[model samples]
Target: MKLRKKVDKVLGTALAIIMGVMVINVLWQVFTRFAMDTPSSFTDELARYLMIWVGVLGAAYISGKRLHVAIDLLPSRLNKKGQTKLKVVINWIIIVFCLAALVIGGLRLVYITFTLKQSSPALQIPLAVVYAIIPISGILMIYYKLSDIINKQL
Candidate 1:
């Protein structure tokens, strides 16, 4: 459990850093464009990539917390047993769909990136490097979901 908690902390710290980077990039771009009369091309691109990282990292964190959106309106109306069963079913579905999509899409992207050696236009960073977050976050999400399913749903 401590390991999982440590991972969560790391993810949280990463999320915070990503957000900070995005904010700083945006502000820096705005300042330069307005006050200094010149805008950096790479700043916006950097911010965009940071934002993508933030989104996927945030998704992994939220998955761990079981905070992703769900339709719970009908659950409250059900009996206790029914509610539990319904919740289990929903969680299972979520886990399956998310994990499956991650595997399929992630593999395809990785292969394409490997073949094409894609890189960002402005930043010159490998596109696959930026996109790697998707699979990593997906793996994290799957781990969290599996733990939750085993401990709570099963």
Candidate 2:
């Protein structure tokens, strides 16, 4: 739990910084395009990439906090043990989905893009680096879920 909290804190700080930079980048783009009549070529692409990182990292942070949207119709009516069981089941489902879809698929995407040497047009950054957030977030989710289960049991 301590380790998880530490990891979450670090990730949250990084995500916050990325989000701040992205917002500033957008503002710069708007300012340069309208006021200066010279649109930034790199800002748009950089902002887009930063947004992707923010979205994925934000999702992981939310998952760690157990703040993801879910229908609580059944859990609300259940007893303590039943609610715990339901939560465990849901966590298991999340783990399986993350493993299958995010971890595996994301890794495959990173590999393919890296091998093909694909790069963003404006930024010229490797697509693989951008896509890496998928697997990274997935792993974070898995770690958080496992920690949640362990903490619950303890």
Candidate 3:
């Protein structure tokens, strides 16, 4: 789990930094609107995009940590062997979902946006850049789940 530790450290630090920036950006937006009597055009958009990254990346981090919320109704009632088998099944289902919905679909979206030359209005950054995290997080999730299964650490 050494690699897991490293990933956790990096992801936690990145999330903290992004959250700080998002807070600052919102504060600046508020300040500019109230004090300067004009809204800062980019802060709102930047915050929005940062939030998207934070949310998705946070999800991936939690998945790696096995901390994401789950009801566990059936697993809770099962014995150890049954629970382990169920967990493996659940993990496989999640892997397939992430592969299809997040990885493939996200890549398609990013490609389309890039091909269309779409850009955010306020930041003027390419839309593809913003959408890129989807597949990245998807890959990270796949890695984590595979590692967990291989190590039998769950």
Q: Highest lDDT among the candidates is held by which one?
A: 3
Question: Sort by TM-score, best first: what order?
Answer: 3, 2, 1
Task: State which candidate has the highest TM-score.
Answer: 3
Candidate 2 regions exceeding 4 Å error are none
Select the stronger candidate by lDDT from 1 and 3: 3
Comparing 2 and 3 on lDDT, the stronger one:
3
lDDT tens digits, residues 41-150, model 1? 89989998898899888988988877778777999899998887887787678677767777568767977996899888999988888888877887888788777767
Model 3 segments more than 4 A misplaced: none
Candidate 3 on 1-154: residue-level lDDT in tens? 8988998899999999999999999999999999999999899899999999999999999999999999889989999999999999888899999999999999999999999999999899999999999999998899899998999977
TM-score of each: 0.90, 0.96, 0.97
Each model's RMSD to truth, in Å?
1.7, 1.3, 0.8
Q: Note the Cα lDDT for every prediction shown.
A: 0.83, 0.93, 0.95
Candidate 2: 10-residue stretch with minimal lDDT: 145-154
